[model samples]
Target: MKEARYFYVPNAVTETELPADEATHALRVLRLKEGDELFLIDGEGGFFRAEVALTTSKKCVYTIKQTLKQEPTWRGGIHLAIAPTKDMGRMEWLVEKATEIGFNKISFLDCKFSERKSLRVDRIEKIIISAVKQSRKGWKPVVEPMIPFHQFIDNCTSAGQKNICHCYSEISKLDFFTEANQSLEEDILVLVGPEGDFSFDEVRYAMEHGFKSVTLGESRLRTETAGLFAVMISQLARRV
Candidate 1:
């Protein structure tokens, strides 16, 4: 049997037409025509088997043949909240890789030392959607709007395991992997600071508010790298 082409359609259903971008890919790029079989992912844990019903230069329509629900292979959720980097490309790269690596959600932090105060949420979301389709992931990671660091901390609910990864050499910090392995909480939230790292006061505040201080490793990592490291460790912990 031929491998089915996969498309991302957030609200896919019977008789639903493919979105503009997806339609272009299906009609112009893939040259799919009526009766061609394809798969659609709604990015909310839904997989749909669809058959092309109509195709034109600018449009592609499909009818759902079957709905396939997929369960997550990994246990727990990985939520990484980090300050956006000054370079937008770096931030986009992190988002793409994190989604492919399988994380549940991502949030941006505006910290004391943050260089970038704003972000293009819409563009970043598109990157995430593309990554999801490329990785063949069933679920989509939520890209939350950028908010002040203090606001994010204060509004955080008292659930799951929370940790802050920073460059505080004086404070005793446990290896992220080690801490994650010993953690009993299934939902994990990790806070990573900006290029200059979190200020001493910010770290102290987070620690006071139930956020444990942890270290990724001895070598210093950039904001994006640290965030990805935290995600990987959190994911690995669940498998152990």
Candidate 2:
């Protein structure tokens, strides 16, 4: 088996000092000794194979030898936009699971019906780092804090197919597979609503902005579940 990979928030492929927290993890928690070999990732596909040169309870210093890049599997990159859950743990779970499944971007939206209105990007970043290392993934998903529904929708381009997961009755709900193509390589974004679902105005706004309505499964899902469900569906569609 390969040595476990760890992501450093800041490290110099040239001569970068590992972040204080990550240094503590390596030196104290993991008990890595000087001259031990390990892998370091930046979460954007950049990787380094390095050897620890010095270790202290508060820090671990390493000398990086080489750089490697990992390619993302999805043909068209995957981005998931959703409302954040009021509970921090639920949102953290979303970040971890989505990172493991390979989402390039995640944006939190503030909708009319959104229960939670704020988020801490730094905390989310830590969760993502842990998830990437645990899942043996080199790339880290970009996590954006809460933005207004209108602004978020306005910024999205008509590049690849844009879709929304809403619970509206008027909208035609189809299994993600039906609308998704096997040859999909275009940038794809899926918008998931909150616990109470997107407000009528929000749904209309997304629809007017070129987001087609879609469903993940029969039962209703929470905000985080819907977001991850979209990630899973998008990954599966890409592989088909």
lDDT of 2 by residue, 41-95 (tens): 8776777888888877787778887777666677787889988877879989888
Please report the candidate that would top lDDT against the real structure. 1
Best by TM-score: 1
Tell me the tens digit of each residue's lDDT in model 1 across 163-191.
99988889889778887876544788899
Task: After the best TM-score superposition of candidate 1, give how far the Cα of residue 76 lies from its true spot, in angstroms.
Answer: 1.5
TM-score of each: 0.94, 0.90
| Residue 203 lDDT, candidate 1, scale 0-100 | 92
Alpha-carbon deviation at 74 in model 2, angstroms: 2.1
Model 1: colliding residue pairs: none
> Candidate 2 has which clashing residue pairs, if any?
12-16, 43-140, 76-185
